[model samples]
Target: MTYSGDVTPGGAPAVRELSGLTVSKLSVGPMDNNAYLLTCRSTGDQVLIDAANEAPRLLELIGGDGLDAVITTHRHMDHWVALEEVVAKTGARALVHADDAEGLPIPAETLTEGDTVPVGDCALEVIHLRGHTPGSIALLYRDPAGTPHLFTGDSLFPGGVGNTDKDPERFAALIDDVERKLFGRLPDDTWFYPGHGKDSTLGAERPALPQWRARGW
Candidate 1:
């Protein structure tokens, strides 16, 4: 079924129609965190990243067909609040980092760096980016046409970085990882779908690395 449009109380789920898939960016809850639904355009198989709040609306989006999997970027409540309900409703397996796995309300398959998750014909490689939380991860997948896409939760944003107030050391490490593992390693053309704001490219954020490091945030 085609998504009608964004629903109220939460910003509309802005659907980005890609080559072989459709990504719906749904802004939910008090923090206005962005949750996404990546579905294969031809097969309709889907994987949801984060649940945030707005359980009712998210349920509507998932509809009757069960979700392939539910991936949590980290363990924060703002990003995972509706996870249990979504998992129960769709019977989808919850996947989270090994460090954050213990904190999830429901059981989840612990994902570590280098593991791959399949959604339809696409494979998402788990990249451990440990700044937002100890187990924070970003999923890197390629579209049918072989274009790279990175789903970075709160670890990295358009111009901002994930809040590191909880653990300064971890945050510092996370920033370094983003630079070395993400920005430095990924292809320049990779599409970055951040957790909070507008989508950016690896090339777009590369130049600002110096500024990010200097700001010390």
Candidate 2:
């Protein structure tokens, strides 16, 4: 039942406990995209975020039991490159924002802001973040102990917000959502898992909010 500290040979990172849920992260593809697997221990229901790359490794993680669904954070090619293969192998439902749904190789059910994605007994509240992609969304889960776990797909990261163009409007919108919907509302202790790289806490990234805004991405 214990997970390794580093990514296992199968490419799955150490399993971490977030409240009642078990989270397994994987780094795949040439882009090093991050894929997350959330399994509800109580119900054995599991969902995956970003079927990026390495179908064989991902399929190994899903195991014979398969997955309940796969949620695509955005329509970027790097994030969903393995979508077709994973879905074909597991028969897991695919979910993406309506705006970005067309970008996928196959049609995916749309999930918008305010919607709740059920993973067994746990629920992930969706938050639509703009700029990086119009349909880019983040998932928020508040543990019983009151800690917030955020899955911000390419929208927010450790150093700063997701890459935005010189377009002031786009940068402004992205920072606005990150500051208000995310930093403004969540506690400093909130844990944010992004589409790539190591996980970060709101507390770790809070003080730099002004800098991120002033510099403009």
Candidate 3:
């Protein structure tokens, strides 16, 4: 499919095919959180990112293919409302950043920056972006034949970074981490999927960084 990244609650997911894996983006819940299901092409092994809501739908989306892990991008309740039920049903390994692990109702394996999450024959590298609840992470998948693809959970979006509650310190920390850890390291062509709404490439959002910073959101 085209992978427009525009998804709505109760709508069909948008699918993106890469060299080694497939990314299926589904929106669930009243909050419109985005849940990503990645399947390894070689092994059909899959991992879900953010089981945000609607346990039955998530389980249905997963189908009989089964799941290997469910990776929560952060501790935000809106981001993991369906986590426990989904994990219980699939027996998938539950994972979250150590800083936000305690916030989850279910116990999860703690992750840190530089951690590698396995998916069948593929792997996703973790990039910790703080200030969006202390343990927000973005997953990076470097396509062997293409550019890097990022799964940014609430830490970044098309117009700006995640909310910092108007706290200058937190805002600064978030902006700094986003700039240094994300924009600086990845190429402009890198396509990123956010927690909600449409996806965008670094090139599309690069010019607005200063604006986002100046506004201090």
Candidate 4:
């Protein structure tokens, strides 16, 4: 099946297979949080993005492969509701941005901009995006034979950036960081998966940057 990136809570997950990596995305929790299970095709090394909620379902996705680590994009409760459970079950290393680590239910190793987290033979580069939260991050996986794939937490979405709680400074910080760190560096074909709802490419949303900025969301 084609990877639509349209997943609903209690519905089936959407999957995308690349040259050396395979990503399976499932939505869980009342907030419809999206959790991604990344498997390195070569070494079968697996990593999960956002434990979110529904520990049993998330565990089912892991099966016998076993998880190497779980990366929490931010410290938001909806993003880590099942984090403690998932970590305890898999014994996977919990990683979060330095600023958000203090807010987590459990202790986590901190991540910062330019840092790389290894998944078997593959690695994800961390991009710290502030505003929605002090240490919000986006993970970038540049497939050798395919286009770039990004896992953006609540910092980015299809229509606009994440909620900054109506603060001008925070809104400004978020949009600027997103434009500079993401749009400025990545190509139009880069596919990004947001925290909730459907996914979209940077090209599709690029034309509306000015509008999103003007509205101050």
For each candidate, the alpha-carbon lDDT, in order, equals 0.83, 0.88, 0.93, 0.95
Point out where model 3 deviates above 4 Å: none
Cα error of candidate 2 at position 147, Å:
1.3
Residue-level lDDT of model 1, residues 58-163, one tens digit each, is: 8888877669999999998888899999988888889999999987888899999999987776668999987778899999877757568899999988786788
- Evaluated against the true structure, the overall lDDT of model 2 is 0.88
The candidate 3 region of ten consecutive residues with least summed lDDT is 1-10
Who wins the lDDT comparison?
A: 4
Model 2 per-residue lDDT tens digits across residues 1-217: 6543244334547688866898888888687788889999788899999998888888888888669899999999999989999999899999998879999999899999899999999989999999999899999988886688999999999999998777899899999998999998899988888898778899999999999999988
Q: Over the stretch 77-142, how does candidate 4's per-residue lDDT look in tens digits?
A: 999999999999989999999999998999999999999999888899999999999999999999
Between candidates 1 and 2, the one scoring higher on TM-score is 2
Q: Runs in model 4 with CA error above 4 Å?
A: none
The C-alpha stretches of model 2 lying farther than 4 A from their native spots are 1-12
Residue 126 C-alpha lDDT in model 1? 95
Better of 1 and 2 by lDDT: 2
Clashes of each: 1, 0, 0, 0
Q: Would you list the clashing residue pairs of candidate 4?
A: none
Which stretches of model 1 miss by more than 4 angstroms?
1-9, 144-146, 166-168
What is the TM-score of each predicted model, taking all chains together? Answer: 0.91, 0.94, 0.98, 0.99
Better of 2 and 3 by TM-score: 3
